[model samples]
Target: MVENAASATGPSIATRIGKLDLPAPTLMGSGCYGSGEEYAPFVDLAGIGGIVLKSVTRFPRLGNAPPRLVATPSGLLNAIGLQNPGIDAYLENDVAKFAERPCAVIGSVAGFSVDDYAYVTERLAARDEIDAIELNISCPNVGSEGETFACDPGLAEQATRAARRVTAKTLIVKLSPNVTDIAAIARVVEAAGADALAVVNTVRGMAIDVETAKPRLGNTTGGLSGAAIRPIAVLAVWEVARAVKIPIVGQGGIENARDALEFILAGASAVSIGTGNFTDPRAPQTVADGLRSYLAERRIASLRDVVGKANPGFAGVR
Candidate 1:
C-alpha cells in the first residue's frame, strides 16, 4: 500500500495535452465516463484532469447487439460499436450541456473515412464547449472498416491531415494497438500534424461460450482492456514517445496511481482511466492523490520531472 503524504503541495500533476492545459494529469477515457456527468454524483468533476466524451460519428449508430460486455480473468472485453447519436443530434442536445462541466471537455470523433473525420472534427471543435478534439481512428469493434485508418499508414496520415486542416484546436489521434508497427504509425500521424497521440485504443480479443458453443459478445470479437493490456500499452507509449515529439495520453488497464505511474515513467505525459472507473467511481481522484503522495515522498516538485525517467530512449520534451 502507498503511504499518504501529509501535504500534496510538493509536486504538480498538472499537464498539457496539446494546447489543452490540464490541472491534473488524469483524464477519463472516452466511452467510460459519459461527458463527465454520470460520475459527477460519486466523484468530484473538478478533481480530475478532463473527460473524453464518447466517440460521435457523422451518422447515428445503433451500436452492437446485446452481450456487448464480458468480464475476463484479468480484464474486461467490450464491443460497444461506437453507439451514439449522430453529430447533428449531439451538437443540439449534448454540446450545450458540456458548458457546465468543471473540467476540460474533449470531444471524441470516430469515423469510417478521412472525409468523415474532417467533417466531424470541424463541427465538434467549432463549438465553444469542446476544449480539444480526439480523432478515434482506431476503434476495434466496428469490424474491419473501423480500424482501417489506424492499420494503414497512408489512411492514418490522410485522416489526421484532413482533420488538421479543419481545426487548429488540439488534434489528438487515437492509435490502434492492433497494428504491426505502432511507432511507424505514430511518426506518420505526427508528420501529418497531430498535437498529441492516444497510445492505444484497445487490444482485440474474443470469448467463447462453452454451453452455447458460440461467441459471447454480440460483435463476436471485442476490444480487451484493463490490467491484461497494461504491458502492451506501456510498451506502445514507450515506443511512440521515442518516435515522436508530441505528447501522449497513455491508457490501457491503468487501475491505480501505481499503474498510472508506470506510463509516466515510460514517457507518457498523462494517463487515461477507462475500465478502472468500473472498479471504483472515485478511482480518478484516488490516482491523483496517489501520484501526489508518490512525488511528495521522493521530494519531487513536479510530475514532469519523472516523465520518461525509466525509458532511456524517450524522445519527448523533458
Candidate 2:
C-alpha cells in the first residue's frame, strides 16, 4: 500500500535522505514557509512533498532591530537573527496547526551550544508530525557561536553528532557559504553521522548607507540570498555532492523551475526556495510545476536522471 501511494503520486520526485524518504524533489525552504500558515493562503500545502519550518532556537529571539530586510538586485538580505517563538511554543502551537498537511514538516533548528541543539532535537523527537530536522549551524547574523560552528569542521561535527544522539529523526546539517572550503566541512559532518547536507546557506554580506556612511542592516552584516548567489550555491552543491555520499538539499537564489533544475543537475536530490518566496508566494508550486514540465518536455521519466548530471567529470567516471 505504501509503495502504491508513492507510485500513484506520479513519476516520483521523492528521494531518500539518510533513512527518511522525502516525497518529492521540491521542499519549501525554512523561513519560506513561515510556520506553514503563511502558505495556506497562497498554495495547497499538500501538493509539495515537504515544508521545512522556520529556524527555531531554545529560547525566543526578538531578532535584530529594525531594517531586518533589504532588497538586492536579484536577492534579499536578511538579518532576522533567528527570531523565533522558541521550541516549546512552536511544538505546542505551530507544529499541531500543520500536523494534518499531506507534506512532511521538517524543523530548522539553531543553538548557542551543543546542549541547546540536543535539547531542541530531543523535544522535537517526541512529536510525530516532524519528519526531519535541519540544523542551522550556519546562521551568520549571530555574534559568536553560530558563525564559529559553521566555519570550523570540528565544531560542525560536534554540533551535528550531538544532535544525532538525541533524535531518531533524519538530521540534515545546513551549511554556510562563508567558509574557506565547503567540501572540507561536508566531509566532517558526514563522518559525524549527518543523514544529509543542505548546501550553501546565505553568503555573509553587508550593505552601506551612503548618507549616514553606515551599514544598512542593524546587525551590520547579513546573509545574502536569491539570484545573486545561485551560481555560488550550485558550485558549492556540486563540490559537496562529490565530497560526500549523503544526499544534498540545495538552495541559495532559486527563483524558478529552471534554477531548481540547475541545482538538481548539479547533484541536489532536492531543492528549496528562499528569497524567491518573498517575491512570489507561489514560487514553490511554480518551481515544482516547472520541474514537471521540463521533465516531460525533455522526455525524461524520473528526477533521478538529472541528479548529478552536470558533474560528468567527477573522478572515476570514464
Candidate 3:
C-alpha cells in the first residue's frame, strides 16, 4: 500500500463499483481524458480506476460550432455537442486502442431517442475492450420537444430500459444535476436496471458577451463544469446514494484528491477527474496518489471504506 507519514500495512485501495472492479477510486472523466490517448504520454494509465471517453452517438455530429469553450471564474463552459466518429467508426478505430490497455475502459453513449441509445449501447456492449457503458441521456430528445432525457424520470427510465434489454454489460446512467428532483430520477433508473449511476453530469449554464450582445458559446448554451459545481455534484450524489442501493460515480469539479475525497465522503464510490485534466495532464494520477496518502493518514483500510463515510450508517468507515 502507498504509505503516509506513519507506515502501516493495510488492505489495497482496490474497490468494486457495480460489476466494474477499479484498482483505484479515481477515474478520468469523459471528455477530459479523450479516449485515454491524450494523457497516456503524460500519466501512467495502469494506476487509475478507469477512463471514460467523450459521448459517442449512432451518427457523426459536427458538435456545435466554433467558440464553444470559454474559461469562467471557477469553471469551463462548453457546448461541444457529441462530436465523435459515430459508433461504427469508433468501434473500428478508437476502441481498438484499448485492446491492450490492461485497464478498465468505459464508453459514454449518447442519443436522441430511446432507440438511438440502445443501438449505440448494443454496439458498445459487443466489445470486449469496454468494461462498462455510461448512458449520457442529457442530450435533447427529438421525440420529446427538445427536452433532455435526464430531465424527465419517465424518459430516463425508458432510455435505461432500452439499453438494459440489449446488454448485460455494466450500465451506468449519468444523471443530470439540472433536475428539480434528482433522487426521483435516480430511483427510476435503478428500477429500470442500471447497475450504477454517475451522480451528475455538467450543470446547465450559459455565458454571454456584453459587447456583442450575443451568447459566448457558439451553441448559445453549454454545460458548466470544473470547480464551480463540486458542491452541487456532492449534494446530488448524497441524494442519489440515500435513494438507491447501486454504486455512484461522483463527478463535476474534481481537481485534486481533496475534491475527489470530498465526493467519496459524500457518497461516491468512485470519483472522476473532469476539467482538472486540462490544467494538469497528470490530474488523474495525482488524485489517485493523493487518495492513497489520504487512506494512510486517516488509517482507512481501503477506498471502499471511505466511500459514503459521511452518510448515516456508512459501512465504509468505522
Q: Count the backbone clashes (under 3 Å) in each candidate.
A: 1, 1, 1
Local lDDT at 311 for model 1: 92
- Winner of 2 and 3 under lDDT: 2
**lDDT tens digits, residue span 1-318, model 1:** 112232344678888888987888888999999888889999988888889999999999999998999999889999999999999999999899999988888999999988999999999999999999999999999989989999999999999999999999999999999988999999999999999999889999999999999999999999999999999999999999899999999999988999999999999999999999999998998999999999989989888989999999999663
Candidate 3 steric clashes: 1
On residues 1-318, what C-alpha lDDT tens digit does candidate 2 reach at each position? Answer: 022253344455656766666556677788767867777888877667678888989999899897988888887888889989999898887887767767777888899998898899889866888888999999999886787888998899999999999988889999998998999999899899888889878888899999999899999899899899999999998888888878898998888889998888888888988778788888877887787777777877777778899886332111
**What does candidate 3's lDDT look like per residue over 75-113, in tens digits?**
998877777889988888888778766568888998888
Clashes of 2: 1
State the local distance difference test value for candidate 1: 0.92
Best candidate according to lDDT: 1
Predictions in order: lDDT: 0.92, 0.82, 0.81
Candidate that scores best on TM-score: 1
Clashing pairs in 1: 226-253
What is the Å distance of residue 37 in model 2 from its true position? 1.3
Candidate 1: minimum summed lDDT over ten consecutive residues — where?
Answer: 1-10
What is residue 67's positional error in candidate 2, in angstroms?
0.9
Candidate 3 positional error at 260, Å: 0.9
